[model samples]
Target: MTNFSHRRVKTGSDPRRLADYAALRNELAKLSHPARPDVNWQSVEKRCDALFEQNGVELQSAAWYTLARTHLAGLSGLNEGLSLLETLITHQWDALWPQPVAVRMEILCSLSQRMQQLLRTFSPSDSDYSALNLAEQQLTRLISALQRRELTPLSPLNALLSLIHHSAVRLEKSNSAAAPVVENDPEVVLTSTGISAAPSPETTRSANEVKWIYLVPPEPQLATNPQIPPPAAATLWQPFALGMLAMLVLGSVALWSWSLFQRPDPLQTPLASSLSALPSVLSPMQLETLRQQGPLSDALFTATQQQLTRLSQLPPDWATDYSRQLVKQAQLLWPEKSRQLTQQWQQQVNAAALPADTMNGWHQGMTELQTLADKLNALDEKRGRYLTVSELKSAVFSMMTHFRQTIPVEEQLRLIRQLPDDSPARQQQIEQAGQHLRAQAYALMKEKEKETTAASF
Candidate 1:
């Protein structure tokens, strides 16, 4: 939506190219929904291939393509999904510092989700269980990789791993209850097919042998410290030392006097100059309050304008990071602003003074605001928040349902699209608000149906 053509730049194999790769990944994700029969897979593939050509097939591109392919293949119920996941897992392990650990974690989560989906479609006895088992193993390895790399494990990844472990346990329990017992020779190696069982003596021996080789004790080495003789103290050097000490003391006094005279006067420095700069650190409550204000309010609008002005004056590196923080803060404030706008519109609707077109514009604006708020809330959830994305999305969807009960879709779209793009925050708000409207439109349809039934009765 942000016109990738204007943003695109030809660059060599550098980490900065990851931005382009992420853009492609997002586009592919939008087109990869399984239930959307309207999506053209051939066109999606062609677009993806064109990106691959533009960037060249590097490890990062391979990762992006494999993830995109996994999603597409998964939708079609092709075994290629599982194969692509396996390839990704292998690539993650084999490559030297493959992609960012976060990207790897996402791939692992995707694989886990695909495997879980597959398990639902196939019978317990189907070989697809093996794929699930492999996915579980890969997740275990991914957890180890996170630990080994000393990276903090993402909350979602941990949740997914816990889920997979629980599912595997449940599957094992169910399989064991239905499985027939088959005793084998004591010497014969017995391995678990799908259910957990006692290992045979041969299997135990093999495992212990590997551990024994790696865990062997090493001989302790003696500890020693190097000793250097101190230099001899001589009266012959005393005269030089005394002269140097005298010079040092005199120089120190002179330097201190000069510094005192040269220091800037604290009273002359304006307090406004210091206060104009953004604080280096904000407290959590302060951050929350800043995030809850509506962008339409004069206070917030002026503050954001000032912040943007300050941002431009900052160094390039500082500006980049600060801009991201500003965007996130703006996003968080959207929901509260949306709710406020809705209330204002409702009051105007009862007044009967506003024209029909004016009332419609208010409704459209509120709808767009609420939609963007939901997405921002979803992004916040990804930052390890307690509220789940599903819950927030559901609530926003309910609000949209209420909106649609009063306004038509075509009018809403037109009004929302016509929203002023005077600032980056306004532009982003308009774009994300329109992007997910249709998906959330029916989220609360069943609830509406229930209410209708009750009312009719």
Candidate 2:
């Protein structure tokens, strides 16, 4: 029932725009509420499908959609909700490797919250208990990974961990009470060493009644005479049978010993061959070289870029050495303009006053930068120093476009006007910085076009 007019979709198919994202969120919200009898879940699911199918879905929006769907599915009493959450966690865990610590932290916290909510809804006897237990363990492992990576745990993360711990305790208690009894004792006796007594009169009478019925058991019997012995041939066969039995026992032992001594066939010994074929560990130098090579395949590039984007969000001192290595790789890949582009990015990041509302846009900008870096690296691998000028221009244009979208001119001007009179000169300096970046981007595009023209000739 929420108004959709204010949530207008931006031009093009980008799902990150507030309007489209808000609409999806509103739909999911309505669908997730179990008490809303008027809501049509089927239509909402179709809408979710459509939204996900849209091009260039932003990470936050994608994450939100996935989570909302998970909740909606749970509300519908479908086990698939837990399955979906588990899949998301697995994918996100792998993706965390290339993400910045802050982003990773955020992702982990969000996943933890989802898991906590799902687990809270499950009874200990439900079929989903095993999955819940696994999720709880995974959350622990994730927290440990964060610690190992030295990412400081946020308040919400700590609270989520506490909630998970409490849920685990409740689950454990319920499971223990539900456990099957392993043994049964039928009789319990009381013993007193100081006193002994004869059986009661009733017990004696009952015992006599049981004995009296069998007291007449001795009955009359008939007798028969003795019989004659077997023939001499039967006696002779007994000795022969003993001799045959001895021979059979000796033969069986001999066969058993022979079989024991036999060697196994070489071709059938698959385990031995498999063990021999196992690869040896790489040397430290080799490992270092592999690390320096960076990501080669598209999947690797995507994962690496995601992680680098997250890393870029953290304080520079946190990942100083790793950042330097990545920068070196970027410089190598885009020898002409990586430094300049990075400087412009830093200026924009520095000038922007990012409130909570604009964080999505900021993250989108970072993702675009990562995409551009990945494209450059790919191009370098394919063409070496003789890059595709058109491709480079396109990548640069895409990055700038995303950056501009993230921090629009109107927002920038508004932020500038908010600056205090004491820092009047700072506003002008920042504005000039923005102008310089725009000029640089224009010049870069022109240069790439010129390069393309020359290459064609």
- Which one is best on lDDT? 2
Over 4 Å off in model 1, which ranges?
A: 1-26, 29-125, 177-457
Worst ten-residue run, lDDT, model 1?
A: 208-217
Candidate 1 per-residue C-alpha lDDT over 13-130 given as tens digits, one digit per residue, 9 for 90 to 100: 4343455555555565663577643434444444444553454333344444434443443322222223223333333344423447666566556544544454455434322343
Task: Note the residue pairs that clash in candidate 2.
Answer: 98-307, 98-308, 99-307, 100-310, 100-311
Q: Give me the runs in candidate 2 sitting further than 4 Å from their true place.
A: 1-14, 17-20, 28-46, 56-58, 73-126, 144-149, 177-457
Clashing residue pairs in candidate 1 (N, C-alpha, C atoms within 3 angstroms): none
